[model samples]
Target: MSEFQKVVLSREITGVPVAQDFAIEAMARPEIAEGELLVKNAFLSLDPYIGSRLKGRHMSGPAPKIGELIPGLAVGEVLESRAAGFAPGDHVVGESGWRTHCVMDAAAAQKVDAAIQPLSLHLGVCGMPGLTAWASAHHLAKVREGDRVLVSSATGPVGGTVGQLARIKGATKVVGLAGSDTKCRTVEREYGFDLCINYKDADWTDQLAAALPDGITVYHDNVGGDVLDAALANLADYGRVILCGLISQYNLPEGERPAGPNPGVYILKRAQLSGLVVYDYMAEQADYAARAFEWIESGDLRYVEDRAEGLAATPELFAKLMHGDNVGKTVVALGNG
Candidate 1:
């Protein structure tokens, strides 16, 4: 066994995350057993999903058991293996959370072609983000040709792909909502969104309505609260909304559920809203990935990333994402290579 440096969760937390809450410390190496492999992490994901863990309502499983290292997803290289079909240097993606190293069973990790895209993308576009966009558009939103589609967090991994998928599905218009003017410009000029609006503007709702005069028929929602309310107000009759995430409320206190959806338009429009978790559709992620790859290769799909320097910056980068400070998938790179 050897002592290695890793980050651990802290006992205290304020409204926003602090570096102290995620302390880096030295720890002994984990022992390997049958069907298990030792991994050296290469890239760790910093996403809004982790904000839920800090609030103690993690939603994945029981509240993370306390004092554990903060939970997340990562990509790593195999260092030692007692597993079949896996050898040293093979890269894998798994729920190894925020750590420098891990010992995970082979069944829990999936082999990845890290050479095709950066390992960080295993947690972003080619991974959960890609799957989320595909399923929400084709399955939950039920988009059709000529439908008017709207996507929030336009440049974020999930919402960015949603707009592209809608366009590829023959949507007549794709309106994207982002936090900054720069992101708004990129979504429209670079990602091919028909219209883009900065949600931070006081008149954003009005601009959104003007962008889709016929009304929003499908909304792939990554942001909730005010944005959700505004979407509700602008939806067409029988419109479909895929409730992908509620990043707005992830940092709230324990036992404090965010307010319920506004009902006026929901009742009048008779809209159809569905909530989804990517894990629920794990059986089909591979199929979705294949489709995304095809679209990407054909120039119908695009992606962006906000790559940070080191594991030590993960906590701050996560906070920036929650505060709408990042333009795309936020990642923390750990290795020099």
Candidate 2:
């Protein structure tokens, strides 16, 4: 292709994102240098963390600047390659951002077997979000059989996957906290969680307490603000809290972000709280992918995608995601199969 479209950060978002915050511009295809591969991105992921990046703050490295391509993960096909192991037609997954095409070095792109799962799955359940769920549930939380697990933002990809994996690992009960009653039903009926509470309801905290009468043993926190505070209040003695994404606070001004769970709760309950960053487990990606695929194939795990067609739709999709409008993993489809 002679030209392609990319989404660039147009302005800093002080609150919720809107179309004015992003610009879709046409650009000449990048020239591939030796040892680099040119990839045609098929699907770009829309995640809550991207919201924090848009505001020039993140837990990771430097934040994306205005006029920069919005940072994201995508699954694509190699169209041209001077890289040693990559070849034309190879499917790969990488940090390609919100663009139709990008040039990536060999070390940055990892080949994926489309035959094992759909290419878009690489950007969701089988990709970074999936790995984040795995690392949080297995490593940080150390979820065990008979544990009473509670997950916040339970309708999103990471929380949904964590709940399912916890159940598969033999957790006696897995409860979820979602934004709406519909989402709560979907989390319980479709994702197989034992129970789900609608956090939007006025009595949701009471509902949470009723759901976890024995207290929560494992808390997979995704929307870490008021929900996290509620989890802390109900934490069992020696309970484990896996700190995942803090979506509820991502779009807020720094000073307006809610005070997080009380530190005194940790001391009084003798609880353990650990932060999780999926990239820290890069060395175990292959193992995580294998096991995720196995669970998916065996009907033990189910995943959903809220997909938008075309690269231009990403900005709106991302805004909706930040406002809790998506039901599962959100992805933008950019290429034909």
Candidate 3:
């Protein structure tokens, strides 16, 4: 009870993360201040965003210092609370980082229903990823009936949710572009995407053209660089593009970044481009979670997750993710809660 463990950055990540870049250490359990809650994390979400955060390439905030805890989203139970509107034993989701225990500001947390089976879902479909999909659906894109929607990185939690929601909204076709063949199959069979293309294939763009003969009406882009460029080339007359994440070059240091997709393509396609910053929609999270919860319960919306055990497993899990090898949302079980 007197000590806890944390995964820290052992060295600066110059490119994609590797297992050696992280090290876990034990530290003294600390007291919580007023307006803070002490939490015991049961599951940690290892997302692609963490890869950019580790390299200080993301816009979220300053990066963690060397030997500091790496950034992560966690679902856990409250061990003690000094904040209003919260009590001990309540389940909460927050930026608890990669740790067995943490004392975080109450304002950073969203209380989740304990009845929701598998607390890890709070970190995946029902948590930030779900909220991202909802916000993009309601505030950004207009998913018209019979429209063709193409989603990049489609097998992951956010992409799968986005594509499925588009499907529910009456989009005639929901296509996905993933890194591997197995992922493509999973998206088509499990997530209900109309078609899933493995972009790793040399003729993938040709396949996308053949699959959607009319061109894509909406492009929900996650990976950038060439993927964005290619998607733009096949865009319909008036496509709406959502720029979510640019994981393609997220790891590159400042000067090494590419020039990115062409502006002419957007102009030629009359593409309506809107960038998605999830924090902008934070105030409406509860309401959206309620709706997403229902869709999940009713089987209208679906998700997949890949889980690993223990905090020590995070580095390896995350490394695999950055290498584009993991299927679905990747989570690490702490086995503490």
Candidate 4:
């Protein structure tokens, strides 16, 4: 009870990470200082950005050194607090890292609604991923009535939310491209996308072309490789592209990364490309969550999660995510202790 377990980056990683890339080690529980709270992390948010951060490419913050706890978002209960307005049992979400316990400054701890049925949601559909989807769709992409939308990684927390919200926003057609047929089904049946194309199929490009007879008006891109190229080729005039996540190249070294997608089409189509970094809209999280709550309750928005239990499972689950095997949000439950 006086110690904590954490997953630390154990070795330098150049490609997709494996369980061996991380080591679970125990450390003495430190006392909280003023304006700090000792949190018992209930869940760990596994993201591709964590991998990007270790390599010093992620823009959210600097890269963590080897042997340091992997820096990422988490939500947990405050077991002890030295800060005002936070007490034991209150729920909070922040960059708590991959640990069973973490000492966080109160200013860094954004308390969340303790009333949410599963607090883990604050790390998923109702959390950062949700905000990322909403902000880009509404503010950056300007998705509106009569627009045709296409989303890649369609079953993920970000992509799934984007497609559904585009539908709710009066988009004329909302199509998604997922890696597998199973994921494609989840995109359409669960997330309610108009059509979900399996990009792995031999004739997927033709399928995508058939699905978007009028071309895409808003393309919410997550995987930025051939997917982006295909979407670009099928873009309508004045098409908007939201660069929410470029997971396809996350594993490659800078020099080994692929070349740019077709640029000629951008000029010909008058394409609008914008990168959507979620941190820029942290100030508006509460507003997005409020609307998300209504949409969830009204059955207008939907999401799924691929979760594992305990700190030991975090690394493997993340590896699965990098392999494109996860259907939705990737999370690891560490317990209330």
Candidate 5:
């Protein structure tokens, strides 16, 4: 290909993301040099974490410069390789951004076995989002038998995965908090959460309390505004809060971010709140993949994808996801698979 299409940040975000914030541009196809590979992207992931990056607020690294490609995770096939250990037609997952093609160092891409799951899943449930849930719940939160767990943003990929994993790990009860009644229903009926509260409800806190009369022992938080405040209020003594994401505040102006899960509550309950960045556990990816794959094969873990067709649909899909219009993991198919 002489040229390829990619989305680039056209302006800095102020509040919520809008289509005007990004621009789709045609650029020359990337050239692979020695030790690098050219990836023809098939699927691009649209995750809540990318919203933080767009607002210049992500904890991971510096934000993308205006006019630069929007940073994201993607699954693709190696179209050309000048690197050892990879060849043409190999499926791989990497931080290939929102692009039709990318030139990446071979070391930056992980070869994926499509036989294990669908290729797009390597960008979603069986990928970073799934791994984040696995590590945060099982490792950071230390979920155990008989523990009552609560997860925020219950219909999203990470939250959905966390609830199921907590259930599989023998949590006595696993409840969820979602934005809408439909999402709450999906979280309960499809994801198997014991109960799901609609945060938009005026009586959501009461519903949460009713669902977990015993108090929450493990809290996996994705949204961090009122939901987090409510979760903290219900934490059992010595409870664990796995802080995986703060999607609620990601698009807000820094000064407008909500405060208070109240420090006094944490101290009074002696609760442990820990932040989780999946990259910290990269060394254990193989182990996680093995176990997650087994869970999928055995029908113990399930996932969903909110897919949009074509690269041109990415901006709208991302906007929809930010507005909670998406039901599961949001992905943009680029016609390469």
Candidate 6:
């Protein structure tokens, strides 16, 4: 293995990412030292957080530096190992960025049981998206049986899992807000959301209120701006709001946010608003995965992936995800011509 392909960010992105923002080229796969393994990337994540990287800001986590390979989380298989405790043909997941080949320390990744499920599941249901949902539902939101829960970006990876997990956790009604009518229908019919509203409709907020007669007790916020405003008004007393991602605000030009919403709502309703950084809860990742694995094994949880076929598609898929073009997790697959 001399070299393989990688997608490198060429410039800071201003708007919807164009092809010129990324360039894919071959580079030598560096030799692994002791305690390291060379992996062939399998699935590259295209998440909303990547949008923040393009703007040179750090909203929740570390910012990506310019001229670096755009950072990402992915799953891959070890092709060669010079490290202890790893061998050729072992699958692992980590922050390997967007690349066809990677050399990482063994401690940075945990071996994946490929036989238990499709390896791609490590990038979706059993991975960050799933854990994000679990943390929002159980830890941040404290959802309870008979609680009315609402989620925005409902067709995307985080929102999709949030709605389903709410149902499993015994929420009486799970209302979802999605970009399109098709996504709304999928949320209702496929993900078991009691009501799914299309954000494209001007009357979406009115529709959401009508559907949630009991008032929303837990809101998993993925989209911000007007949607967040509406959810705020509909929350019941003692409501819990879990701030996940603000996809709508991620790509806005500087100084674009208008002052809106009073902070007094939290005091008025005695609501608890929480902001979460998933990495802070890493200690519980294994426990979260164990529970999610049980749900997956018993067919109680469902997942979807929007897969792009090659390393060349990473940047394109990243833009697509920011534009809400993908349902569930967006991934770029590498390997096997």
Per-model C-alpha RMSD: 2.3, 1.7, 1.5, 1.7, 1.7, 2.4
Q: After superposition, how far is residue 287 of candidate 1 from its true place, in Å?
A: 2.9
Between which residue pairs do clashes occur in model 6?
35-83
Error of 6 at 252 (Å): 1.5
TM-score of each model, in listed order: 0.92, 0.95, 0.96, 0.95, 0.95, 0.92
Best by lDDT: 4
lDDT of 4 by residue, 1-337 (tens): 3358888889887677788888889878868999999998888899878767777787878776779888988899999999999999898998788888889989978888866657778888889999999887888987889999999988989999998888888899999999998999999899988899999999999999999999899999988888899999999999999988878878778556677776888899999999888889988887787788788989899889898988888888988887788899999988662
RMSD of 6: 2.4
Model 1 lDDT, residue 160, Cα: 89
lDDT of 6 by residue, 186-223 (tens): 77777778888998898887898898877889999987
Higher-TM-score candidate among 4 and 6?
4
For each of the candidates, give the backbone clash count: 0, 0, 0, 0, 0, 1
Candidate 3 accuracy as TM-score: 0.96
Model 4 alpha-carbon miss at residue 198, Å: 1.4
lDDT of all the models against the reference? 0.81, 0.86, 0.86, 0.87, 0.86, 0.80
Which 10-residue window of candidate 1 scores lowest in summed lDDT? 1-10
Clashing pairs in 1: none
| Tens-digit lDDT string for candidate 2 (1-337) | 2359899989877688887889898888889999899999888888888788776677544666788888888888899999898889999888788999988887888888877567888877778888999998888888888899999988888889999999988899999999898888889888999999998899999988999999999999887778888999999999999988788778888567566655788999899989888889987876788889999999888888899999878888988887788899899988564
What would the per-residue lDDT of candidate 5 be over residues 136-203, giving only the tens digit for each residue? 78899878899999999889889999999998888999898888888888898889888888888999
Clashing residue pairs, backbone N/CA/C < 3 A, model 4: none
TM-score of 2: 0.95
Q: How far is candidate 4 from the true structure (C-alpha RMSD, Å)?
A: 1.7
The list of candidate 5 runs beyond 4 A from truth reads 1-3, 254-258
